[model samples]
Target chain A: MDDEVIICRCEEVTKGEILKAIEQGAKTITGIKIRTRAGMGLCQGRTCGRLIARLLAERTAQVLEEIPPATVRPPVRATKMENLVTSHGE
Target chain B: MVNKADAVVIGGGVIGNSIAYYLAKYGVDTLLIERKDLAAGTSGACDGFIFLQSKKPGFDLRLALESTRLYENLADELSYDIEYRKCGGMILIETEEQLKAIIELVDGQRKTGLDVKLMRIPQELEPILSGHIIGATHSPLDAQVNPFKVVLGFAQGAKRKGAQILTHMEVQAIRTRTVRGELKVDSVITERGEIKTNTVINAAGVHAPVIAKMVGLDLPIIPRRGQVLVTEPLPDLVTSLLVDAEYITLKLAPDHRGTDGLGLGFTLEQTASGNLLIGSTREFVGYDRRTTYHGIKAITQNVLRIAPALKEVNIIRSFAGLRPYTPDGLPILGKLRGVEGFIVAAGHEGDGIALAPITGKLIAELVVKGKPSISLDEFGLERFK
Candidate 1:
């Protein structure tokens, strides 16, 4: 992949940026995610998590399976504040 | 990995990393062991407010004041851009009862020579705030920084100064030896290997008790859950870190019963990236860090009551963090009485980010000089007894 190629479309992180993060001692997917904000967008790494793991493995020469997936927090999908609450216009 | 170090600091959040940075800078052979990556715990999942006004007057407030002063030049000193913003802070008051409570709190803080005042919400912030918000307390000293960057900066600085930072390495056991009929820390045992050391510092945030329990000590630290909401990047909707007066009530009084078994506090602040980060609900769910519908709903309802215009803003994400709550609000710092060569620097709870620098400096001072400039007597583990 070219350095300019975008890996995380959600955050617009490119291959070069991720490689820089790896060089900065980010060995895992979560490490790269935090350093480059690759998987921190609205999608919350759903889209770019595997891509980031592969990139990290390639750069660090680690097995792809060994790299853990980035942490997933809930609402699994984005929900509106109004929808979450029950009482309306209090 | 080396078999020996002058000091071993456990955990790699902002607290541990900051301790490592200071210890390494002071010319100690420091080794930091983190179970996960840096800022992966409470430090990563929370807001970045260096809010001095919210602190209880006297010990806690004085410590925050000193820490805020250190943060002024921290970025330059660490050679890292932490996205520091000294935008000040406010505590919004909705009711006359809240106003009365805030006045008393502000008066206590003022007596300590802190530059805080109770006043109407400034005109610039007036339009965004709901009309129900009657008043606010403002302090120029309150500030914020990128929490992740701060952790990374400290870790990097520590590494530059020859500290060995081993991430993903969990300390399974703390090995100790009784020399001349006195027990002393001997080494830290990990799954991979044991690193021999005479000094061990626990800065593990909420998980400090787990490490303490390994050494036959019981730390009275429990995890209090807080859930926060984040908005999509937008124009500067809020400048300063804003919290409801009720948040202080929930924080200061542990037994203060809140609505629906959850302590909901309105904390709204716009990040440097332009996203308005709002939060939060303090609940005692016993280390269950999941954001529930009940929590999300409570927080949303509470926040909207203070800033109704934020209704249109899209919430990008919501997350939860476990604050290390001690019996007292203050952290358990300094060495334990029976534990030789062991020091504790955890249990800062929500104030960890604000007090990181001072905690680090004080802990390092205790390790190196056997005395911190600021006495840790009040903050020691003995206080709980």
Candidate 2:
């Protein structure tokens, strides 16, 4: 696969990286956002969400818009996952 | 007996409120109804850019020009502050092809008596922009306003003039009655109850089709979703509205760039509160109002290209709104052929905020006087047939 096909514009993650992540069982956009940090930038994946959705659809052979949009958590920017997990657990 | 009025304007967005305001001013008792809070639809969520630069070279341009002129004095006429700023707009051209297109656009604009000029390395284009650009076209008559304030002002003004504006009043169906040989709209059944009236105006924005269907009329209006983002206030990086011609082909103008279905794009603008409005994405994904990562990146990347200095600005929030799009990109206004007393003022699409005041005035004229001051032949509902 061509590296020029950028799957995630936020982390500059290429299609190859997403495909590799998928192979490692990173199925959802949130999962990919956590693992590869593909959408964990200033925009929080507003730019890369649709592209990731399309890539997911093409790879999985599903309709594009039918794929549920990424869950938009408040403070829309990137947050420390550890902090969230610890706060919830406490 | 149920409460009644001469006319009921459905959908309490800018269009509905403006229509109700004008109607009441004309001494025609009116009622304005909204399913949610006023301006809850595209009216509240959009950057109120009253622009003429991006309009297609013919009839649409004329509509924009007329609306732009009306917006110039709307704040004063309504005796309310709508933050109407006649700040010029620039369409940055990155390639020779785009420059050619800009030239054509300028030619059309000049023919229509618009104050437009193609700027090649303009000196006035300063601190507002922080990137390399090949060329740009400037239109001095373009302006911006706070959509929320404008809608509120219209609604308040309408209420002050005897129009009963009711929020959270959803119209369930339209009740028809025969007067002599002619069929007329008698009342509107709401979720709560019914309000009897002689006339009904459909300004339901994205839900215009649904409301029209209640009266057995087919209104071919589809929801075109546009997502917008807001950045924390910076020192006025973008003074005048800036756009990219190539981005226009992608429908990714600077104000509403990211969330539309178009690939990585951004439109940047500065509000009176000093916050930067960055946007957006345009997609034809039915009524889904979800924002995607691709939409955000598209806007961010485009914003960076236009103003690299904005890299440090933190985006505070992001949102999506749907524009009621017609197939030919023109609005469906005026009364339906077979449906008596049922008029449509929806499908202004992305231009709704800009076109609201004029559309209201026109609808008021059509309803009260049986014809409009301007030609409504092109905007008639019969075009769908």
Candidate 3:
């Protein structure tokens, strides 16, 4: 892959950026996410999560299945603050 | 895994890495062991607010002030861009009672040599804030940094200074021996092998009590969980580290359980990348670091109350971290009474990011010179007794 090719479309993180984070001892998707903001954007790693994980596995010489996914937090889908408030007590 | 070192620091969070760096710089043969990667716990999961005004008056504020000075020169000294930024901070005051309380708190802080003052909501923040937020307190000293970079910087700096750092190595046992009818840390037994060392610094954070238990000592540290939310990257919305005045009340008052028993508080910070890091709910839920639906709702409600304009902001995700809480809010630092060569520097709770550099410097000083320049009397482990 070309170094300039974008990996995380939401964040516009390039392949070079992901590679740099990997070189700096980012062994997991969470590590790469925090280091490069690759998967912390609108999709919250949904779009680019697997691509980055594969890159990490290939770079670290680990099996693709061995690479863990980035931690998925609440509000899995992007939701507005007002939506939460409007929902009220269930 | 070699066999020996002058000092063996346990846990590789911000605290442990800082201690390792300072020890190595002071010419101590330092070896640090981490169960996981650096900042994998609270340090990585928490926000990067090096806030001062919210600290309890006297010892806590004083230590924070000293730590601030160290943080100012840290990025340059460590030769790593920890993204240290003194963007300043503010506390949003809503109620008349909040204003009065903040005034009294600011007065006490000013007396402690902290440069802080109460002020009207600034022109920039006026549009975003709700009408209920009548006033604010601004301090030029409160700053922030990238917590991950800070931990990595310390670990790298320690390595550059010839200190040995071992990650993915869990300590199974703390080997100690009795000499002259007193307990002394002999070495640490890890999954790899036993490391021979006379001194052991416990910086295990929320798991500190577990480490202390290996030596038949019961530490009073409890895991207090805090949950936070992250918004999608947007144009600079709210600037600086902004918190609700009630956040201070929640932090200082132990009995004041917040909205729905979640201990909710509103702390807003815009990251360098323009993503707003909103937080948090403080709950004592043992070791569970899971975020709840109610916790998320409470924090969002708080954001809307503080900055109604943020009602439209889309939240990307929410996460939780466990803070090491003690009986008193202050961290447990300095040596233990019954143990020789055993020093503790954990239980910083939310102040871990703020106090990491100074804690490292002081603990290093305590090890090298047998005492820190500033008194550790207030932070001693025996205070629980």
Q: lDDT: which candidate is best? A: 3
Q: Compute the lDDT of residue B105 as modeled in candidate 1.
A: 90
Off by over 4 Å in 1: A61-67, A86-90, B121-123
User: Tens digits of per-residue lDDT for model 1 on B42-144?
Assistant: 9988998899987888988899899999999999999999989999899888789888878999999999778987778554555687876778888888898
- Model 2 TM-score? 0.79
Q: Please give the ranking of all candidate structures by lDDT, highest first, separated by commas.
A: 3, 1, 2
Error of 3 at A10 (Å): 3.1
> What TM-score would chain B receive for each of the candidates shown?
0.98, 0.94, 0.98
Worst 10 residues of 3 chain B by lDDT: B118-127
**CA lDDT of B112 in candidate 2?**
77
The lowest-lDDT stretch of 10 consecutive residues in candidate 1 chain B is B118-127
State candidate 3's TM-score.
0.95
Tell me which of candidates 1 and 2 scores higher on TM-score. 1
- Predicted chain A of candidate 2: TM-score: 0.70
lDDT of 3: 0.88
> Per-model i-RMS in Å?
4.2, 14.8, 1.9
